[model samples]
Target: MDWDKLRIFHAVADAGSLTHAGDVLHLSQSAVSRQIRALEESLETTLFHRHARGLILTEQGELLFDATQAMSKRLDAASARIRDTEEEVFGNLRVTTTIGFGSIWLAPRLRKLYANYPDLSIDLMLEERVLDLPMREADIAIRMKEPSQADLVRKRLMDIRMQLFASPAYIEANGMPRRMKDMTQHRLICQAQGATQVSAGAMLVRELMTYAVERTLTVNNYFGVLQSVVSDLGIGVLPDYLQQDFPQLVRVLPEVESNEVPVFLAFPEELRGSRRVQAFRDFVVEEVVAYRRARQIAAQ
Candidate 1:
């Protein structure tokens, strides 16, 4: 019932040590211990089991900790909403995307975003896992396919296809594979069969495997596959967008490519009015437009 005591309890429960919690809350260890004792007295429950090594949360403590953790996330969400009301765009923006796209594409282009909003702090979480946007796991996400999560503001960013490519050095040494059947002579570098990736990429890799290439290398992510290709190890199945950045990578088997994989950018509908979200969404749209224009010009 007492907010201050509950706050102290949450901190102690989180840190598992009174001294550590005191260090965080700027309170003396004895004072923190006193507050925790008072909270337990008020609630008539033993929240933590004290041991020589450290404190372990009791069942009640675990339940209370869960509630406190939710409260913290809600508080963070409220703070973000409050900050968004300001005219100036600033504060932390958590963006989640696949590692290959985040590291190879979006990360390189983020210089322009930071240049425009110098105060904006971006936490770029790169993984295949789709973070819960509505629950505030991340502020925004750029995913390979449309997000199935409800109450999301989704936009199709662009479409990408998985294509075969090799370094100039590798092609020079092993010669180019002009047809899908010719792949047997070259080593294939690709994402592992059971790895987490878009369906289109997996299909492409499967097709490539049917060629029975003499040697092969499998990585868990496209970034690793790209690294091996660029290192002149072998031909790799990679996204077409990479061609713009790594111009030296020679496209292999021009007629062989995967079906288009739709790229989508999404955020919680509640974040529709968030200035930071809008700024980032607009920036990504602009980048996608510019990328398309660049590709068109190069074709000409």
Candidate 2:
């Protein structure tokens, strides 16, 4: 197969117009069209459906596009790994984690990481969706549950539990609930049961709702719940780690909390030698250790 033709085909298929694709590829429209024609003749099949507006991929084209897309991703992965020299850890490191953890816990600590590696560029992807680490959908992932995907090098970072919390002002005004059943007296803030959150956190919300509190406020994520709680709107169900960051938030009904959720940091096994991966992993591990120490001291 001709790599140049395939590359041109990929560009044409991606852009849906020879002119647009050629503009991107720095080739004339006729030259791009010639390559596509040569590619089709070599493959003995039409790859596109010619139309007035733009080109649409044929079935064969779709298959080829899929292959080309995978190839591109693999090439990108290889390029990234090659740039990850042992002497320096300075390049784009795509980090994926849950929105709650990314925004609340990991993001704030990134200031220190930046201070240490001033030249490092980070692409932080905050979402509940599990990205394909093996396929290079993302470079690194910090997930609540263990990644069952093969070919991933995973390390348990820590454990977290969902607990009830409220602002001190809210607690002082509404009085703290000493027991799960006492929650009926105040507004209960939490993530909706259907929201994309860890199973343990969802289960906690489900169990709490079984008490049938008189009033309730359900948000899509912990961030929103935390905002409501801090605004003194109500008590919120949030991860225990938040207490370390927001000390003013008072824990409520500590006895009623979610089961432990294990946090893991993972990257493709192929990235074991990647300097960027090692740097980020070490930074996170150090931060978690420091966080644990701070909490231990606070407890005493």
Worst 10 residues of 1 by lDDT: 69-78
Report clashes for each candidate as comma-separated counts. 0, 0
Q: Write the per-residue lDDT of candidate 2 for residues 1-300, one digit (tens) a residue.
A: 999999999999999999999999999999999999999999999999999999999999999999998999899899998898879979899999988899899999999999999989999999888999988989999999999998999999999999999999998898988788888899989887888999998998888878888699998877888899999999899999998899988988878888999999999999999998999999999999999998899999
lDDT of each: 0.92, 0.93
Per-model TM against the reference: 0.92, 0.93
Q: Encode model 1's per-residue lDDT on 109-220: one tens digit a residue.
A: 9999999999899999999888988788898999999999889999999999999999999989999877888888889999888999999999988888887876899998
Weakest 10 consecutive residues of candidate 2 by summed lDDT: 205-214
